[model samples]
Target: MIQKLLDSGLHWEKKEFGRYGFLKTSGSTDTDIYFVEKGSVRIFMMDENEERIIRFGYSGNIIVSLDSFLSGKPSELYIQAIKKTIVRTATKKDFYEFIRSSEENLKFWNSILEDLVLQQMEREKDLLISSPKERFDRVLKRSPKLFQEVPNKYIANYLRMSPETLSRLKKS
Candidate 1:
């Protein structure tokens, strides 16, 4: 059903970006949700003088700044390519129209939201209760390919650990 909707009306365009390319920057009003076709993207925000990674979206995942996309406000986060990437993107207007077009679409949207919420809760729990090693282990268990696909520094940042700690954990 979702595929049908995407195929029928969503104007998906294939976009390619080089590593470290910025898809959307802080204070940008244009909001487009991207489906990763290949490679990865990192969603992050500036914290004082540092880049605080919020999440990493790999292949077969969707990436978007939810607040900016939904509220029609400028984004506070930066979405950047972590590797040479290909993604299919749909504008915010097209996405919302599709969601409101039918009951099935609405249901699908709700389910996606539920899944996002649950994932967020689980990540929060892991971050709050797990050690850096434990967090790194959990991520590795979930996506071993991430290590090969993304830079060690980005992975360390995502796991809220220093690069040195990540190196030690990998060695162990």
Candidate 2:
């Protein structure tokens, strides 16, 4: 679905970011959708003082701060580059206009939205599991490639566990 959008010849601004570079910052109304071309990006927010991991975008993935995009308001979310990354971006208006231009594009957008909702539900289920092992296993089953693309420290944060615990689980 995302590939279809990328292949649609829509005007996209190709941008590059160094490690820790921010794509979106907290307290900003940034509704741009990004398509990752290389490397990776992390979507997070500060919880008190701690940075809470929310989601990640790898090569070939489309990412946006959805809440901001949908609500047209500033969000607490922050999007950052995990490494040297290249992404193509389109404004919310352009994206919607493109989708509206054709029934097929609309279906593609719907599928993408559906997948996002389902992924959120799966994350909720993972959070409901009290056991760390269960959460680890569930995520591994769902997105095994995450382990390869993201650093263990960030993965541990996303799983709400310590780095040592994640290491232990990996070793087992």
Candidate 3:
């Protein structure tokens, strides 16, 4: 279904970024959505003295600053390549036109939103109820690629644990 949409006149620009390249920067109003073809992206925000990682997007995933993209506001988040990466991107205008073009497109858009919401809910629940070790274990079980592909500091921030804690967990 996604491939169908991508095939249906939605212009996709393929580009490569070096590791740590900024795909979207904080306070930018760019609303381009990216489909990861290879490698990973980390969505994050700088909070005072710390970098808080909101999420990691890998191959076959869509990466977007949803609030900013939808509202046409400056995004508070930054989207950065975690490694050498390939992505296909479509601008906000093109994305909306495609979404409004057909019932199928609208349905697909809704499904994407639903999945995002569900994932956020699960993440929030885990943060509230699970131990740090449990969260780390869950992430490892679900996306072991993150451990190998993303740096330890980023992973520690994403898991809401200290780097020392993560190192200890890795040893155990």
Task: State which candidate has the highest lDDT.
Answer: 2
Tens-digit lDDT track of model 1 for 10-45: 789889999999889999975798888898998999
**Model 1 root mean square deviation, Cα atoms:** 1.9
- Candidate lDDT values, in order: 0.84, 0.92, 0.89
Clashing pairs in 2: none
Residue 159 CA error for candidate 3 (Å)?
Answer: 0.4
**Which residue pairs show collisions in model 3?**
none
Q: Where does model 3 exceed 4 Å of error?
A: none
Task: Name model 2 segments beyond 4 Å from true.
Answer: none
Across residues 1-172, which tens digit of lDDT does each residue of candidate 2 receive? 6666777978799999999999999999987999999999989999899999978889999888999999999999999999999999999999989989999999888888898999999888878888999999999998999999999999999999999999999999
**Relative to the unseen true structure, what is the C-alpha lDDT of residue 162 in candidate 3, on a scale of 0 to 100?**
93
How does candidate 3 score on lDDT?
0.89
TM-score of 2: 0.97
Candidates sorted on lDDT, descending: 2, 3, 1
